[model samples]
Target: MAFALPVWLAVQEELLAYGGEVDPESPSCFDDFDDEALFQMFHLTRPCIAFITDSTRIRMKKVALKKPTLPVDAMVMVTLNYYAHGVSSAAIQQRLRLSQNDCLSIICTVSGVIAGMADQFISFPLTRAARTNVALKIEKLCGITDALGVLAAAHFKIRASPYEKDTFRSFVNTLGYTSVVSQFICDSDGNILSVEKCCVGSTFEQDLWESSFKGREMEDELHGQYWVIGGSSYNLSKHVLTPVSEPANEKENRFNQAHAKIHDVMRITLGSMKRRFRCLMQLGFAQEGSLDKKSNIIKACSVLHNISKKFSVPPPPVVGKIEPLHPGRQHSVPIQINPEALKARQELIDCNFSVASSRQDPPSETVTEEDL
Candidate 1:
């Protein structure tokens, strides 16, 4: 005698036969969620979600169809939900009414597609004119003349595996958690201009900067014209401005305080990104997934961060810092200070921040008739 198919299998077969159609504006659909609620669920508004689906539809459709798949919007939602919540494929399987494998495949495919769009949203000003524009905008915003951006590093924790012991170890980071390190250069408005994520946790921040193409270009091509504000842990170079190790006087103290504006912008940028895409706070992975996969996912989220910022998406509720999986294993590296760079910094402060230069001309001792 023939046996009846399982209920779940029956539903799956029925869904496939119908050629999935997820209504975009139905009350039950994501459109039903107000902007805030939608952002809470997907970290993006409905219009932004629509834009992503429209942009990726052609390529997404090009993927070989081994079986019936969800609509493009549904697939995008699945991936975004995964990113916004840091939940596993299985966690979203039932809600989306798809198998875990399908959810996983959609997540990977959509991630790769979105990651390919990075050049559209993220870029560094390469030309002198472009760099000058960025510098002007930053100066207008933060009062730091000739400032290009803020250089900062962020760590995203990952799980330890039996394999790749050396590469994924947490010994290098102060938090003592296995992580992937990302270096970002953000402008005064918290827009990311350059991001490098090829390095692992054990890599020193200075080495990461030194090895980057943008860093080298700043040293060779853009040096003496534009500078990025960085923390003391970074090397002091012609194109990098680190705060005074010990402020000797009021001028130096004021200079350090101004330098801090760009640094604070970087922190806000990184924090906003983490808050938008919670997955980056603590990346989870399947047993079959590798570090490269995690990297691609992070790259995709970076692109999404730019898009969300462009559309003025609201940030989600603030979350506490990611607890270190391997605490009490702090490490520090000495910064190689450059004495020559000190002269440049001093000249900058003397010209722009000195008491005489900053003070007004006693409000024009001889007042005009209009003033009277």
Candidate 2:
């Protein structure tokens, strides 16, 4: 009779094979990839990867426990690959030669580490000097004088969940998938200034904004010195500007055109982020955890996206229409406008976006629709 190998021996053989394939001590396995290859695989350049690894290494070391600890760089690579591609965890485990537990642990640990850096990477300009600086950048880019930032929302698709199933389902008939909506505010250079916690896809952008901490205090915070632009779906306030419903004259048309240029900043910011970390396009997080965890993963992706911008990483090419950040299926109906806000918008148009104003002081850069 043939003798069978012991179960322990089989396990040991598997461990030996994995050890041979990936040396836990040497993370230089990444050195084999060129700049393009690294970007293609992880959506980050080598220098950027190094920066992230160094920043999060200390925290990761504290949490590590099990044997065959992965090098900090290797852990970073695994996590980044997970973010860049929303592939199954099994695929990552197989390719990286890691146990299922190890792969999941690395992803969770690295994600939390990156997300913790949000306060550093993601912030809005609240002071007068800072707000003025942002306004200047917006003026230089699109001639939208006194505009500090742009606001919009995107629907991030996710798997079905038993909790809040009705709320997660897309309210619109055209979009049949379940998703969570996230709001973003970005500056003229497409740098994200702020991101809100994820809400159900069924939530209206205006409702989502109104319920946010920032939105509640925005008018008081601005004190009429600066204005944040948003779509017609949002309520018009003293510090918020929305597009004119029907252009009665050439000046009104000019105002809308200039408003569109600034608005594209948010769109480009959202699109580039989704392209870089495709997990946002189709979030793959397990539904068992608190919803906050999923939201943090999204936040972590935005933090990484901002870091990529700091490193001058070029965005991936657009495949088609830049994914719409405005989630409303149908155009929003015009709401009652605040008298003060209406006057402010009119004054803004007459001063900066009028036909005469355009002739006197042209925009520094003319952004074509195709450019977006």
Candidate 3:
């Protein structure tokens, strides 16, 4: 009787407190939405939601937690709300009825997981032939010779570090606040090929760029007739081609013209990314947390960006903060250019001229991407 009394009292309390039952004519959430509407809300197709939930479950299987805790679907829901809407944890808690800490944990965990799946989300072409394929696209779209991709740095505004004074001395002030910087390599199609984060805001872009994996990879992967484009920030190298400082001839002038076209494509790509995930666009991440949360947010966004492109996910409203055109000039950077690299660059310059100059087949020393 005592046990039954407790159950009866609980049921009475539930009914009395909530005004009959909690049921209603409609629920203001994904439950009532159609497939198209669901994607608009979640930024994920139904199949993608299932795949992510399945992946999260498989990853979390080793960790034993209380049974009454939120299921993997809810965890993913918590994470998706941030990517889709860039809402605060409190708002998510109110909307989804989960704790703020739960949302934080889920975001960090899911981001870290998705960040590691770069191979699946990013299209990093290997083998010379594969690279040539990418280069060909640049030629088709931007009319640049043997161009593989465009390189740029993206800055995310973070909360002013408690060590604001110390950071001032240590880093570039991102409009009077601490910020994080990541280097991006994107193909002609606006697909992000590589994203290297974890650098402090003050770090000089050229130095940060050189230390990146893509930097070293550029040295080895590109050879005779292959190169990537960068802004004036990067020093010219065997594999990297930057705009000419002073156009000595019509050929150099023409190269800059083609360069601007390709760089514009990169700008469009960065703009679309921030518009799709507004969190990176605004400034409200937890100030105390290490860049772990912000970095993961960005990492997850990158993956989702790829997923969006793949599935044709419509982007949110666009308000760009990442400038597509680059700053910093090359003359300011002192260069001890490698003799071989210098020679190679000249050959490339001459090669571009030949392509620009004539319709005849390019000499063996140069590669005309049109034939490829």
Ranking by TM-score: 2, 1, 3
What are the per-residue Cα lDDT tens digits for candidate 3 across 1-372? 012234334544544453433232323244555787766667667645554554444435433334426655667777777777777446558767767676767677767766665655666666678688888888765556777788887776655546666654443433444567778888877778888865556666778677888787777764445677888777778778878788888777666767776776667776777776767765453333366667667777887776666555556555534454435323454777677766776676677654564432222332221211
- Total backbone clashes of candidate 3, pairs 3 or more residues apart or in separate chains: 1
Clashes of each: 0, 1, 1
Return the top candidate by TM-score: 2
**TM-score of every candidate:** 0.77, 0.80, 0.76
Cα lDDT of model 3 overall?
A: 0.64
Please state the error at residue 129 of candidate 1 in Å: 4.3
Please report how far candidate 2 places residue 56 from its true position, in Å.
1.7
The alpha-carbon lDDT assigned to residue 302 of candidate 3 equals 83
Runs in model 2 with CA error above 4 Å? 1-29, 58-69, 88-96, 161-176, 222-224, 285-289, 327-334, 356-372
lDDT of 1 by residue, 1-372 (tens): 001124223433444455433344443346656877777678788766765665455434444444436766678878888898887545456667987678778888888877776665677776677778888876654456788888877777776664755544542366666677777887766667887765556666777788887788888855447798888767778888888889999878767777765566766677777777888878753222345677677778877776666666767755665232222121264655677787888898887767634422232232111121
